[model samples]
Target chain A: MRNQLRRPLATISVYGINLLHRQNPYVVAWWSAAFPGFGHYLLNQYIRATLLTIVEVIINYLTNINIAIVYSFCGEFDMAKSVVQPRWAIGYIIIYFFIIWDSYRSALVQNKLCHLAQLENERVAAVNLRPLEFQYIEPKKPWLAALYSFFFPGLGQLYNHQFALAFYAMMWWWIYLTLSRAHESVTLMMVGNFQESIAVLHPQWLLFMPSVVGGSTYYAYIMAREHNRLFRIEQRQFLAERYSHSEVRLFPR
Target chain B: MLVIGTFEHSLELEQALSLLEHDGIARKHILVILMDTDPKNPNQFLSKPTDLYPNAIEVGTAFATACAVIGTSVGFKLAWGPIFSGLSAAVGGFIVGFGLYLFVKKGIHKTRSKRLPEICVIVQCTEEQVELVTETLWKFGVLTVGRVKEPSLRA
Candidate 1:
């Protein structure tokens, strides 16, 4: 009876968001196929995703991949061949395919890990000694988290209560943006100053943007999903402790 | 000889290391690798434990010294006709030594990559002390234990 009295009646929403749903592995794979590190972002493997994205953009640019594709589409095969630096292009092919394969594999593995974690949470709840009082949290929406991260590199992590990671990410992102002059270049390009825009951009620093954006977006989504799962398990545990078996029936007679 | 053991938890690994220390194993002979299982635990994931290859620097220096000596001798012999053999020999020796140092460093890195794992303890000991070392590890409830072939202090 003391346990019942001690238990909090109200459910608290930790992040004040709704429950996160499971993501399809194929969908994640498709995202990665579209963009090299997108799948890793969806899987919440931030560092790997970031590194791969960085590699992808830099290699793609160095190999003149965009120009080659453009020339090929225009039926200028010779021009395409001329533009591509074979040395860098060969390395680009290896990394690009590897990223796609790795992201797909990681998605499958993370799905299994998520299932195992859920089971573990259930087991832990049964033996947990603490009273389920005062600290209730709600589920998070993955898409919203991703959207927040899209606006700012580390905002999603801040939402997830990961302060240090958010700080570092924000700091690095700001530095990259400043050093690359990416925004200014885009603005100039939009104003029909193509040569001036090209001159303003620093390829070395600009190359880092794709990876940072891909990593941030994906990380935000994954973290939100994980946070929601944890919230659900906690809520279940709290519910289990607060109500007795006799009081809460699955089906009424 | 080297004995390698894996442990599930850091506490158990620490206990095992302490037991090994109590048994008179030198601190330098023991190496531990702690793998992070929890993403929330930043301390575990972020900490880069010192590498096991303590002798890499010493080995690299030895190789560099040998190469430098050979280069100096060759340069002195080739420049016998009085053009400050000391300066040419010094430059040649430095270049050769630096190159050999880089090569040795690469080899050490390759060896480490091939042998090391995320969560294992490696201990270097004499052939006579292998049994005692394995026994101590077992007593502390190690997850697995085995003898590694050609276990050098350089690992």
Candidate 2:
């Protein structure tokens, strides 16, 4: 009986507008495995992702997992063993596995909901005008969205006009850039200060770059494609409503 | 006289619609029907999911990102360094993923091609205006067009 009350509207907010579309469950699971919170982010459960991400960063830092991975990779098994805090590591493991399972389960439920939403085929406002932000449905180039994220983590999100995510990603990218000393390392490498570049980098912070860059870029690319779909769906609705005139005669007068 | 044409859903088509309005066809005399794809053109997705599914680029981008993360993580052990290892993995991973996606798609579905005009516009007008209507549709690069005359009825 309450299924009628549960359908989320066009998913528009000052942050952005999104539609419930089907996402591959396995893909969502893989993203979560790559990074604890990314699967949730892809699911558009932003609040949970934000919280989980914050927890992952803090616990990972406390547990020294990144440094341990670096040490283990560098053949310093003893160093890796010595650095990790078992208590935090245990907790991190629990949370990590939970998110992966949670996301997969969520994806299944959401995928089913996606069919219902499609069946409903509710009308959406193409242009959403507000004083501080605006969102509109139009064709977006998926490659361009990927390219923007490649250049800078959050730019693709901005191009999709999903401002909340864009700003969130951009802010994190700058922090990663600053903390990793990535630019300084490149400058040094350009001049052949190889050891210095290694010395300047914080391995723990640098490690976050991979998942951050990957998750953001993938999300942006997918979102752009979705926006294009929304454009067609919207245009189709407009044409049908406006010009499929009821008065038109099937037989001549 | 009835004039009909098919078009892609694009801004140019919308412009053609407004121009038709300007050319004095009454709103009621025009009918728009969204067409299902011609069987010959099967890859283009509209109301239904197609072989490409949601996005064409997913195979390349998704795997690249996911694999790049693993490469970067494991790169700490490699002699060259994280940046080089990550880049190499992203490229290599994308190629492998793209190839696999294509292979699987090929294995599952018949070959596919580019777009076919998927919208149909039919206008009822006097014989004198048929030329004008056809010209407007043609100007928009309509994929196909046809004309028909309805028989007069006698009481």
Candidate 3:
């Protein structure tokens, strides 16, 4: 039973074992506020992020929170207050604050650990090859990653092998498109039915798209650049160990 | 005597280290600091985020968020409506913000890398052993070598 119950914290696919680095607590908290699970996701706390994301979605839908937020943003406070299911919404409030605090505290602790780990200077296996997966330290261009993300919200993450985030963003992008009727609205607008285009859009859902797209693109670009640096560090460690032994010769014929 | 030398991080340098060890120099007395000049490792002018020195994640995220919010707000009045207008603005804003970030970061990174040692090897030994260590280093195509009678400053 113990053996069967065992689980790995991170893997090459599900959530890669990211390098330790100082992450800003405020940034992590801000992301949590942006989307409950996002801060935990950045911290590489996949399990928590997944759970929080599910709960957030369920609660948001049941409480009509998104609709309420839309009304609130549009300055219809009475409608906003009326649309929300008080009980469900109330439960989410605590979780929202908890996640922000949780992610912030976790980041601070993680930063300390990162400092210790760097001081230790332990070498890592730069290459991992398996029948199903190939992960290696290699150079990747930030610009190219950004371009891919610009084309689609998650393709850049996909390129970076950030499978969990890539898939998550893609799934949400599709959902956003469907709920907002963004494509349909664009089509209507293109065909000269401006009024119909405007009428078709769900502004609440559409508003979420900008932040998600912008964030994803920026994240992908930064990750690419960072990974390149990691590759160099890992490669340097490898070379020092592997190639530091050689015989000297005074003169060669 | 302390023998200090810098090499281009190649096989010859490794050979020199091995020869020094074979010449009865203890491993602990020999130090090697490798330079990051690998051909495959690009991004020579940018570095990973770390404690004091870091690539700012918040700046990009905050900039992107701000752009996204503004774009979305302005889209309410545009002809393409909110969807297309907001998206374009978000992307445009992200590019400008991130690019500006990289420009500043690159300058810092370039200077930091310049200060990094290039395949430096420091050997500590007595006056009697200096000749052997120096001979071994020179035989293997070392870049530059110097000797110090006494060590001082940042030992």
Candidate 4:
């Protein structure tokens, strides 16, 4: 009776594990297309993602990309052209395209590498007893992970047991918040002081917001998925080791 | 004496460490250098070295100083006051110097040799224990093994 109840639970867990293992390369690429460095963040290339984000913000602001975008959207093509400095605009265009292509290529490569690593891990699990008896965490929901990051940049990392990385990200986020006066701007906007809100915001620091938010969201989701998959793998190994040769047989011949 | 060995997989490395521990080797003596093969593994995280040109900063500073001198002289020829001339020249010189530094650094980075192997195990032990350490590593099918000079303790 107990075994019968456990069978369905096992099947559900296996289905969840399969879902966690699969990461769409196109989805990663699309995240990068939406925001530079987001895809790299999803791939767990923190340093590269941070550097690319910094570059993207600096270049985007210097080239007046956001202002031009706003103007273009408002049907002011000439004003958009006028706002952008040609030399910097050219540099931004090149880098923008390069980042997209590079991120897409990297995502594809990393997906393949993850697949290889999973296979290798499975092989190791089959033969090794060391990881079998270790305590394992329950799989985390990707949406929940992303939601945590949306509230605070490093909370997701903290949830993933990356304490040091979480601290670093939290420090940076605090600095960004302070320098950008982001909270003040939001408060002002809410209170109907639109002009003051715009005045309070530092454009240079404000540019960091999209990257930080996007990167954190995507990174949290990816990390949760990867961690969940690893947990499933470890669970399988543990179960296999424990039940490979059960002494008590329930069925009689 | 110091011993270093490379391993392609973490499992083999883990096995090697356990073997060393079983042989009564001190935990302090065994150091695992996790390779940056996995982006998710943040062990020994380091920013990529982008400054490849030797003395890039000094070269940039020297160039800036030279440009400032030239600018000052040119400003004087144009009858600009010393203070205004100095300020403008300093800013212009800094911009030019920074650009030069970036250009040179990129070129040097392109030509320089790649960094060392990412994953390896480093063991610090007495001379007599070196053989045992090497044997243990060999038993676990380490990728490569070699002796290394004792690193300096001074900061």
Query: What residue pairs are clashing in model 2?
Result: none
User: Model 1: per-residue lDDT, tens digit, A104-158?
Assistant: 7776775565444434343222121235322223356676876677667888877
Estimate the TM-score of every prediction.
0.42, 0.86, 0.68, 0.49
Better of 2 and 4 by TM-score: 2
Chain A TM-score, each candidate: 0.60, 0.92, 0.84, 0.72
Model 3: colliding residue pairs: none
State how far residue A5 of model 1 sits from its true place (Å).
Answer: 30
Q: Which structure among the candidates has the greatest DockQ?
A: 2
Interface RMSD of 1: 27.4
From the highest DockQ down, the ranking of the candidates is 2, 3, 4, 1
- The interface root-mean-square deviation of each model, in the order shown, is 27.4, 4.2, 8.9, 22.1
| Tens-digit per-residue lDDT, A135-229, candidate 3 | 65556778788778866788998888877778887888899899989889989987888878977887667766665665576667667766765
For all the candidates, what are their Cα RMSDs to the real structure? 24.4, 4.1, 9.3, 22.0
DockQ for each numbered candidate: 0.01, 0.38, 0.15, 0.01
- Each prediction's whole-model lDDT (CA): 0.54, 0.76, 0.68, 0.56
lDDT of 4 by residue, A1-253 (tens): 2234311111122112211233456555656655677667666566787687678767877888766654554467897789998889887778777877877787677556555554444322222123323222455777687668766888887775555557767887887789778778667767777666656655445445444654565566566655554544554444345334433211213
Model 2 chain A scores worst on lDDT over the 10 consecutive residues at A1-10
What is the DockQ score of candidate 3, to 2 decimals? Answer: 0.15
Model 3 regions more than 4 Å off: A1-17, A247-253, B1-33, B36-58, B70-80, B88-155
